[model samples]
Target: SVEELRKLLSDKDAYENYLHSIEEVKQLDTLRNDLRKRNVTLARHNLGKESEMAELRNQCMIIRTTELATAQEKFLDAQRREKEILARSSPASILNKLQEAANAADDESESLHRKLLSGELKVPEFLQKYRQQRVLYHRRTLLRLAA
Candidate 1:
């Protein structure tokens, strides 16, 4: 009778161990499902970040292109203005015209002086003409200084 009781106790212990193993398996399956859900959420978040980055990059490229085009247009406008200025008044032609003006002023002063010396112009007339000539000369000098 004691041997029979030992056999029954041993069988009961084996059954309990099998039931514990099954519970452990169920816990492992639950943990696996939770991990799978977290992985899907992370994947979606990564995709959203990547899309935002792409849009930002496109906007940056568009801004850069517009700025470059504006700069190019401004550069072309400046070049056109420079050409117009050069065509209207080249340095050589401006210098030649200035030289001719100086020579004319000198000749006029010498002629006035000769006329006064020869009594061709009265003292009063000569003084007035001389003052006018001096004013003209001074104006020219001021213009040259300003330039």
Candidate 2:
């Protein structure tokens, strides 16, 4: 009877251990499932970020291309205007024209001064003509300086 009782106790202990192992296995399976869900969420988040970054890069490239085209068009327009100006008047010819106008103004001023001194022109008329000649001469001089 003692041997039989010992054997019965041993069977009870083995059954308890088997139940504990089953519980541990269930806990491990729950943890594995949680880790799998987290991995899926992280993968989705990474994909969204990658797509957003790609769209932003494309937008930046488009903006840069538009700006480059506008700048190139402006450069070409400036070049065309420069060519037209050069064709119409060379710098040397422009300077010569200004010089001739200045000389003519000086000659007219001298004639007006002579007429005033000789009493051939009235004082008011001489003053008016002298003022006009002086203004013309000054304008031509300023133009030459700017050129």
Candidate 3:
């Protein structure tokens, strides 16, 4: 109202204070709106960054799974080759191992006998161990006969 404006104008101090307060409120509102806009922009940028991070993570997992599968295949192939190589060894090698086992059993039997003679082992224990060694020695000899 023009008349109301004139009344406020009659008091210069009141009019000026009221105008200054209104200007301050308008500036504050503008600042709040700008801040809100900036917040929205930052949220959009963060969403884009999150999607990029997820893509990179997926790529890394794909690479890792492929590499692990390749490694597993190589490991299995090496194991198969090792088994084949061992199986291909000559019969002479098998005969030598059987003969060595027989000799070791004979030596263990002799040691047990000596322990029995020296009274270091009980007669029952010596008999059991000596019987076991003799059986092992005969079994190894039978295995070598086939070789």
In terms of lDDT, the best-performing candidate is 3
Between candidates 2 and 3, which one is better according to lDDT?
3
What C-alpha lDDT does candidate 3 achieve relative to the native structure?
Answer: 0.91
- Backbone clashes for every candidate come to 0, 0, 0
Give the lDDT of residue 57 in candidate 1. 99
Q: Considering only N, C-alpha and C atoms within 3 Å, which residue pairs clash in candidate 1? A: none
RMSD (Å) of each candidate, 1 decimal? 10.1, 10.3, 15.0
TM-score between candidate 3 and the true structure: 0.42
TM-score of each: 0.36, 0.40, 0.42
Q: Predict model 1's lDDT versus the native.
A: 0.80
Tens-digit lDDT string for candidate 2 (1-147): 777566657898865655557977779878999999999999999998998999999999999999999999999999999988896599887898898999899899999999999999999999999999989998998999898
Q: What digit string (tens of lDDT, one per residue) describes model 1 on residues 3-66?
A: 7566657898865555556977768878998999999999999997998999999999999999
- Whole-model Cα lDDT per candidate? 0.80, 0.90, 0.91
Which model is ahead, 1 or 3, in terms of lDDT?
3
